[model samples]
Target: MILSIALKEWKLLIKEKGVFIWLLVMPALFIVLFGTVLGNLGGGTQTLTYIDNDRTAASESLMTALGEQGGFKLEAKQAGELDDQVDRIREGKLGFLLVVPQGFAEKMTAGGDSLAAVELYSDGASDSAAGIRSALQNVATDYREQRLDAALKQAGVGDEAREQALQSPLQIEEKPQNATEGNAVTQVVPGYTVMFVFFVMISMIRRFIGDKTNGMTARLRTTRMKPLHYLLGMWLAYLGVALVQCAVLLGFGHFAYDVALGDLAAIAVLVLMLALCGTGLGLALSMVVRSENQGMAFVQLITMGGAALGGLWFPLEYMPKSMQTISHFLPQYWGQLAFQDIMTRGDHLSGILPSLAVLAAFALAGVLVALLRFRGFMKSAQG
Candidate 1:
């Protein structure tokens, strides 16, 4: 009997043209659009046009160090070409330009309070330009240390003493706790999937309201069907729909964008938990609203507000600390955490158990609220 009701709900959902378009089509479009547009926005190698005015071995060594750092593409030009290079940078034809001043090698070799300064001009807005600037800074630091070593040698200082002098007094070793290799596609796909899954609530709630207004619920009371069976059937149907929606989006992400589903079992568990969260919220919402307009208003508030605060549109790391703190109250935040743990961090199911537990708690709360309100809601409709 429960299967029969569940199948009916599924069939009705499938027959709705709008549901098919929103659930399946729109998510795929967003994944492609966002993945392609913002995929390469992060850090990478940059090209710098440089004029070595100090045509000395020291300047050569600096350039070699910059090249060895592997963060810049060096384009050597004549010293007289500085004006032309600046023009190219302004015109967006070039990213950055470096001028190694005359006597730079002499100043570096002298190794005193006087320091060799290389002039770097770049578009501050470009990420590539920023990378080049950082690389240049590191190269200059290394060159300064080398000069110190040369000075020590001239002063008859031992090799070990020179090395000890050059070594940093304070050192930091970075160890990543999570193995998540974040990519544009991986970040976006799961986020949108969670956003759209919650969106399914609108349709599901509307369906429940329709059954009430059209006397379907009252008619069912005359049959052998218990209210528990009816409610369970609806929950199962919506849960199934949500699962299918996730599967389609994830499958598309895997095949089209080559997104790795790190720990498939963990991903599956997260998807199921998210589906439960959506289903329970939808059912609870269906019982509360008195009209279609109110239900839609709630849907908009829940789906959009949840997605925005939950880091569905962008990473929480980019948000203000307060905003990130507020996000913890939203179920979508936990869902994204679980998804990111598996998709990005390559964490096993055990690693994401906390997020799963939170989502399950949310689901339980929503179900309990809906069950408590179910009787009153039906009575109000009948009256």
Candidate 2:
């Protein structure tokens, strides 16, 4: 009887084409969009436009240094264009401009306390200005080092001593670990999957509210379909929905983006647990909410707020410490953690037991709440 009811719900859902658009198509688009965008964040060159009033070897050398050190594309504007560049920055159309003073070459070669007045005309509102400033500082440091090297050479210092004097104390090394490289696609795929999984509640809310409003619930009481069976049947149907949703999303990530999904068994188990958790919450929501509008408000709070706080949209380390601590309480966090563990860290089922346990706890809690509310929910429907 429950199976029959679930099948009926599935058929109805299928006929409503919006369900597929919301559950499948939307998430796939989001995956493709964000994955392609955030994946190439560090790939492109940032352009630096400069006015070289000095028009000398030293000014050109500084420009070359900025390009090399900052990985910036060099754009030389005539000194007459300085005012125009400044106006563009003021108008928010440009980030910044570099202006080398007329005496720049002479001051730079003088090598005393008198420094070249190389002005970075910039808009305070610009995001790129900070990076450009840092690049300029690096160029300044290199010039200072060159001066120091020349002085040391004049003072009869050996190559080894000069090298020892010039070397910086800080060093950064890039070391990558794990079974698969972590990138935007991996983050975005499981993220949107977990986020939209909660959206199954919206459909449930619509269905339950429909039944109650249209007298289907009252009519069901006259038949052999018990109220508990009705709840279970609806829950079971959405469980299938969530499962298919997760599978399609993960499959898209795998085949389309080549996001490595390590430990297939572990991923499968996590997806099952995630489906249960999402659908269980949906069931509780279906029983608890009085109207579709109110249910939608709750769904927004759950999906959007949870996505932000649960680290679904980005890494937890990027969030505030308090937020990171709060994320542990959300099911989205556990779902995402389990997915990243399986995909990036090469974790198997045993490795993800904690996240699975947390997801299961949330699922159980939701079911228990729905069960407690089922009597009242049905009573209202019958009236």
Candidate 3:
């Protein structure tokens, strides 16, 4: 009997044209738009405009090194073009401007106590400005070392001593704790997947409200069907729908973006727990609202608000410390964290146990609340 009711619910959902748009079309659009646009923005190379007033072998050597390093696309402009370049930067046509001062090479190679400075003007607000500055600093360091080596050789320093003198006293080596930090695809796919899964709440709440207000539950009371069977059927149906939605989204992400699923079993557990939470929350929300209009309003508030505050729209690290602390109270935050652990951190199921426990607690709390209120809500509707 439960299977029959669940099948009926699934069939009815499939027959709705809007279901496809909500479950697939909208999510696909978001994934492609953010993944292609913002993802590229985070990692793409910057273009730099430069006026080389020195125009000597040293300056040419610096430009050659910058080009070979491949951090920035170098655009050489005459000194007269400085004003125009600055204007373009203000207009967002360029990111950075470099002025290699006259006698830069002479000053750099003179081996005197004086310091030579190359003026760099940039849009401090630009995303690529920091990286470009870091690359330029590295180039400057290499060039300074070359000049120092040449000066030392002219002073009759032996080859072994010159090499030893150039080496830094302290060397730091960096190793990535997790290899997937800057991957844009991994960052976005899990965020939107959790977002759309909870969106199923809208459909579930609508069905629940319709069942109560449209005499479906009253009619079912005349049959041998128990209320528990009816509720179980609805929960199972919605959970199935949520699981399918998650699978499809992750599958699309894998194929389109080459997103790696580190621990498939852990990811499956996380998705199942999240779906259970969604189903339970939907059921509880239905009992809280008296009408379809009320249900719709609550649906929008909870789903959209949860997605925003729960780290589905942006990473928690980007949020203020207070917001980050508050996000722990949200089920969506735990869901996203679990997904990120598996997909980004390459963690096994053990790593996500805490998040899973929180989600399970949310599911249990929601289901218990819904069950306790179901009888009262139905009686009120029937009366």
Candidate 4:
């Protein structure tokens, strides 16, 4: 009997164009779009103004290094116009500026104090500025090292001699247990999984709300079957669909795209938790909404907004420090972070316990709330 009801829900969902488009077509399209556009967008260039007061050989060499880095388009401008350039930066026309003060060339040659100012002007809303800043700082460090090398060479120290005197070089070797987890896609898979499952579940719940508002639920209740049985059957059906969809996506990521599934067992636990949460949330939403149309809007705002906050499509690393701090409050963020730890960091169960605990809490809370609300609705309907 439950199987028959589930089959009916499945058939109805399949027939709906919106559900079909969002569940299957939309996710596939996003995968393709991310692969095409964001795949090659990491090395974004920054527009920077160059203020070269001392056009010495060493300064010129530093400028050449910056130019050759190809991460920035160096614009030659005056220091006097720094304020105007800052205004341009505010207007989103520039990333940052580098100012080489007077006597910089002489100072480097004389092994004296050569102070160069790099004005990091960002709109504070731009992620690219951070990357540009990091890359440019590296270039500056290299240039300073080269200047030091030249000074040592003039003082009778050869390249081999300077190499021997270097002390305490920091070497950080990142070795990923699963190479796939090292990338953005692998780390973000959990967030994506949670987000899409929520989307699908929400859509299904909206359908349920529609059935309730249209008196289909009450009509069904008029039969010998109880409302709880109907709701349970519907919840089971939606959970089954969510599980299947998650399995398909994971399969695609693993077999087709070679995306990492670091620990299959751990991933299974996470997916199961997500399925439970989705089912409960979907069912609860069905009861909360007055109608399907209202549910649709609510679902979009809730699921999509949560995904964005949780860094499903992007990383929280791209967000500001404050935003990153706030992300911990989001359930999706906890799930995603746990997945990343397992997949990217090769973390064991112990390493991911906190995140897993948080996810379990969310799942349990959602389920309890849903059951309570569902029971209340059934009692009211009976009364």
The prediction achieving the highest TM-score against the true structure is: 2
Q: What residue runs in model 1 are displaced by over 4 Å at the alpha carbon? A: 28-39, 51-64, 75-96, 101-115, 123-129, 169-176, 179-189, 209-230, 250-269, 290-293, 313-315, 340-354, 372-383
Model 2: per-residue lDDT, tens digit, 1-383? 79988999999999999999999999899888988888878766778989888999988888888888755888999877878889999998888888888989999878769888799888888577877889888877887899999999999999999999999999999888887888888899999999999989899999999999999999998898878899989999999999999999999999998889899989989999999999899889888898999999999999999999998888899999999999999999999999999999999999999999999999999999999999988889763
The list of candidate 4 runs beyond 4 A from truth reads 34-38, 44-181, 255-257, 317-329, 348-357, 375-383
What lDDT does the true structure give each of the candidates?
Answer: 0.86, 0.90, 0.85, 0.72
Q: What order do candidates take by lDDT, descending?
A: 2, 1, 3, 4
Error of 3 at 354 (Å): 2.4
Cα RMSD of all models vs. native, in order, equals: 4.3, 1.8, 2.7, 5.3
| TM-score of each candidate structure, all chains considered together | 0.76, 0.94, 0.88, 0.71
Query: What C-alpha lDDT, on a 0 to 100 scale, does residue 358 get in candidate 2?
Result: 98
| Number of the top lDDT candidate | 2
lDDT of 3 by residue, 210-305 (tens): 887788888887789988888899999999999999999998999988888789999999999999998888888887877878878887887788
Tens digit of lDDT per residue, candidate 4, span 138-188?
Answer: 886776777777778889987788876553478789865653436645644
Candidate 1 clash pair list? none
Error of 2 at 144 (Å): 1.8
Q: Show the lowest summed lDDT stretch of 10 residues, model 2.
A: 38-47
After superposition of all CA atoms, the RMSD between model 1 and the true structure is 4.3
Candidate 1 per-residue lDDT over residues 1-383, each given as its tens digit: 78889999989987899998888899889888988777866545566679999999989888888898885678899977889998988887887888899999888766458778888888666754666677777876776677678878999999999889888899999887656667888888998899999988888788889988888888887789888888899999989989999999999998998888889888988999999999899989988888888999999999899999999988999999999999999999999888888888878999999999999998998899899999886665551
Model 3 stretches astray by more than 4 angstroms: 110-115, 124-128, 174-182
In angstroms, give how far residue 376 of model 3 lies from its true place: 2.5
